[model samples]
Target: MKQLLEILGFIALVQGVAGLVHEFTDWDWGFVQRLDVLDGYEVYASVALLVLGCALLAAAESRASR
Candidate 1:
């Protein structure tokens, strides 16, 4: 279970970083098509993902230390 969370956290972190880059470079990837629903809020959504990813990563680490 912990491993799964860690994997998800990593994905989220990568996606968030990618989103930030996309915002500047406008380099569209196939996966980003799924986010069309975000409309004009992609940047904010990316930030939210980043925060959630960080939280999940922290949770995973905390669990590991226990």
Candidate 2:
């Protein structure tokens, strides 16, 4: 279960990074079409995802320390 959380957190981190990249650049993630179509709100969503992923990572850290 813990490993699952770690993997999910990693995925969220990667997606957040990808979202940021989409905001600044013109990169696509294969199936996530419409990379060129976005609003300003995407940045906020990306940051939120990043924060959530970091929080999950921190949770994992505490678990590991135990």
Candidate 3:
């Protein structure tokens, strides 16, 4: 379970970072930019992903220490 969380967190973190980078630099990457539903809300979604990633990582760490 902890491993799963960690993996998910890592993926989220990568995607979030990629999204932000793409927004700022027009790097042409990340799944955020490919979503039609998000449209003008890519930044917000990216930020949410970033936060979710952190939370998942923290949860994984706490689980590990148990």
In terms of lDDT, the best-performing candidate is 3
Summarize candidate 2's per-residue lDDT along 1-66 as a digit string, tens digits.
667768878887888887788768968652123444545567777777788889888787778877
List candidate 3 segments past 4 Å from native.
Answer: none
Model 1, span 1-66: residue lDDT tens: 689889999888888878877888887742332576887888887887899889999999988998
What TM-score would every model get versus the actual structure?
0.87, 0.77, 0.97
**lDDT, candidate 3, at 15:** 95
The sequence of per-residue lDDT tens digits that candidate 3 reaches over residues 1-66 is: 999999999999999999999999999999999999999999999999999999999999999999
Worst 10 residues of 3 by lDDT: 39-48
Report clashes for each candidate as comma-separated counts. 0, 0, 0
lDDT of the candidates, in the order given: 0.80, 0.72, 0.96
- Residue ranges of candidate 2 with Cα displaced over 4 Å: 30-39
Best by TM-score: 3
TM-score of 3: 0.97
lDDT of 1 at 3: 94
Residue pair clashes in candidate 2: none
Once model 1 is optimally superposed onto the true structure by TM-score, how far is the C-alpha of residue 3 displaced, in angstroms? Answer: 0.6
The whole-model C-alpha lDDT of candidate 1 against the native structure comes to 0.80
